[model samples]
Target: MIRILFFILIVLALGAGFAWLADRPGELSLIWQGQRIEMSLMVAATLLASLISAILIVVWLVRVVWLSPHSISRYFRARKRDRGYQALSTGLIAAGAGDSALARKMTARTHGLLSADQEPLIHLLEAQTALIEGKYDDARKKFELMADDPETRELGLRGLYLEAKRLGANEAARQYAERAADKAPHLPWATLAALDYRSQTGQWDEAIRLLDQSRAAHVIDRKEADRKKAVLLTARAAEKLESDPKGARDDAQAALKLSETLVPAGLIAAKALFREDNLRKAASILEKLWKHEPHPEVARVYVRARSGDSAIDRLKRANKLEALKPNNVVSLATVAESALEARELQLARAKAEAAARIQPSEGIFLLLADIEEADTGDDGRIRHWMNQALKSPRDPAWTADGVTAPEWLPVSPVSGKLDAFEWKMPVAQIAGPVEDGNVDMADEAIRSLPPVAIAHHRDEPVQKPVEKVVETPVKATAPVKVEEIVEQPAVKTIAVPVPTESVIVPETVKTETKPAPAKTEEPVVEPFFGRPPDDPGVRNDSAKPLEKTTFRLF
Candidate 1:
């Protein structure tokens, strides 16, 4: 638009000049050596414009003729290159679509038209075709070629890493992952692969350094970095505790600073401090850890922090921890164990039973059995609790990645994952759903148990508690006939055993049977579902009160 407007303005200016010249005409004259030429100013300007236009046209024609060969060759080359690119695109599509035949065909065609040097991705297409055809050797070779080139180094490393992982060559995979991560830490697969290998190999310091690098590169967030670092520090501390307690303590303290609720870190730190004879610091660390997340190990370590403390002193310390985290099953169990060690059987029984009521498990039941044996030496009661322990769900242990460890660990044994162990019931230990109301029922059943009159040493006589007069429940329907109520004399029959045969013995009844019609109903007798009346196995109740009868051992 500007060009057109400027052209219009120039034409107008020329017309105005011509008009001005027409009004005062003048001729421009040119003189050569042998000839003279003359023309008007307007005529000379018109001729000059015509000559410049003709010159431009002639120069355009000459340049076109001169470059025609090169232009033709360039046009054909562009067409060939376009066809190769089209084939490459089709081959990539087919590879993604899993059409190995078409991909290979296009790959060959592309190779015919273009070399790997001309298009780097042709090598990738060949690799894809080889992979789809199950020619892993060829694919690996192609990847190696790509890896040797600077342009496709990261791509080649990624391919090599994945292929190595697939082939189960963990060392080669780690090498490739480290190479990729060293070049670009932003790659998640590379960073994770390198970190996993480092952790699995127990290179704690290097693993920590790698984590720092990854955090700085923003490949991993701050929270994840701190968590991984804490695990690494804890593992390192555990390894160093025996050799260098000072260094181990520092590492564990750092780990605790990173994650306050990490129980293993707290335990390690406390143990290191114990080795250093820093009893106060060790106890303080354990107590803090217990408050955050109460663990039985923490309680045990805390109670036994002092080297030469008596069982009584340990029991007191256990109680203090229980005060910090009261009513917890772990705390209660720890205290019960310490009390048992101190020979305080009653205290142990109370705490253990309380813990069982809260969360009944094999460990608590076993502890109860131990208390029973210690307190009264009651074999029946002890066997009852021992059987219960065998039947009850197993207690919580340090489980990680489906493998249960006897103790806490910073990393999983199965997957090498950090911070994996948890203090919870193992999956295999779960029986089924347990009613929460069972605790109340169990308490009632235990209370109803008759006190055992165990004999003491030196032939001391044991005193038994007074028996109560208990009423037996009667479940029956009354007769519909409206007859006068009459009491029928009925004798309770008890089965008596004999060496040869069994017989029924009559016993006196204190509680009256429910009233029925005067003459239609038979005398009410206790129903017995035993062997035939003459069976030798039949035993008599001997008219003993329910309280005096040792009915069930458990």
Candidate 2:
């Protein structure tokens, strides 16, 4: 509508100009060179009209000759470029879908129809399709060719890495991944692979540095970096703990400072302190950790800190811990160990009984057996504990990985920490051997025990009180049974033959040489499971030097 209006305006202006020109006149000119000339108005007007029309026709002819062919060729070229891009897009989709046949067909068509520079992506798509089709040779050739292009170099390398991994050439894959990481550290997969390779080779420092680099590159979360650093620090601490325990302790402490709730660091730090005999420090660390997150191993050490208590006391504490966090294996195991530490044979056995009832663990029974062996020198108890351990159901969570059977361990078995009280058995000197007619087979018993139950004497008495009681808990249940509780004064001699039983008969007896009328106590009775006591003051009939047990007070 605007074009029509514009045409009408142009026509009206032309008509008005024509009418004014016709009405006014035309020009007549006389040359001044030599002569004069005259012309009519109609003739000059017609001449001017012919000149303007000829100039317009010449301009239109020039435009048609110079511009139209080039425009037409450009339009066709653009259409072809569009079709090439279309084929390239289809080939890429086909490659992604693992349709090698369609990709190959499109690749050939694209190459034939388009220039190399115009269809760079076709080669990448073809190589990927070859790889998906398991044509590694073809894929390698195509990828190597594409590698010459800087834009596709990393892509080619990544494809090669995948091929290497598929072929199970881990070293080759690692090399490629390292190159990729070096070239582009921000690429997450390459960075992770490089770190994994380093970690597998035990290059912890290098791995840690790489992790730091990844963090700086914003490739990993800060929290994850801290966690990985903590893990590495723990490994370093473990390595140094043996040769340089102080250094190990420092490293562990540093790790804990970085991540206060990390269990491994707490464990390692506690162990390092304990190795240095810094029991108070170790106990303090564990106590703090237990308040936040209770672990079984920590509980075991905590129970051990409360040393010198009978097994019952330790168990009371452990049971309280269990009440707080039920079915705690570490606390239960420690309670079992506490009995051995206190040399409370009955208490240790009772802890084992309670632990076995709470959860089926062999460690508890082993602990009971160790205590029995140490207190009474009983081999039968060791066998009994071993049998109980064997019969007990296995606890997958309590048992360490790869162990088929859990072994019994002694409490405070560390050298210089073992309980070393000596039993006071004494005898009179013999003069001569007479006849063969007296061996009291009904009374005495002796047996060798496992070395785990044996305690070595400390060269020096502890000046400071050992922090053996890490925890003290009040009892909520009924009191422990005291039928097994017997009081016997320290004995000095024995005049009976050894029996095969496990119990230490009479529990205790005072020396016969001491004053007798101080207290005429009733004969002590053994608990239900214990070996019955022999007759008091029974004379031995043995004449073969009367091999009586004896002790000399220190």
List, residue by residue over 1-554, the lDDT tens digit for candidate 2.
99999999998987887788788886787678788777867667767888998999999999978999998998998998888878888888888887889888888777866787766677787787787788889988877777667877777778778878888888988998898898888888788778767765667678778889999999988886776667667667777878998988998898787678766677779888877889789867877777676666677766655446666676666655555554455555555565566565566566555555555445555666676656654443456566655644443332212222222111112211111111111122131111121111101111122232223222322232122211223232333222221223333322222233322222234443222222337643221222325424322346344334433211
Query: What does candidate 1's lDDT look like per residue over 1-554, in tens digits?
Result: 99999999999997897788778767998999978999998788778878998999999999999999999999999999999999999999999888999999999899888878978999899889899899999999889899888998888889899899899898899999999988888988888788888888899888899889999989898998898899899999989988998999999999988988888888999998888788888888888888887887888778878869999899999989889989888899999999999999889988988887777778988898887777776444666677667667788789888889998777688876667888888865433324565466346535643344354422243443332322232222321122112222232223222222323232334232222223536642322223334433323557443332121111
Model 1 scores worst on lDDT over the 10 consecutive residues at 479-488
After superposition, the stretches of candidate 1 with alpha carbons farther than 4 Å from their true spots are 1-65, 183-186, 428-554
Q: In model 1, how large is the Cα lDDT of residue 415?
A: 73
Cα lDDT for residue 478, candidate 2: 34
* Candidate 1 residue pairs that clash: none
Q: List TM-score per model, in order.
A: 0.69, 0.53
TM-score of 1: 0.69
Task: State which candidate has the highest lDDT.
Answer: 1
Score each candidate by Cα lDDT.
0.78, 0.61
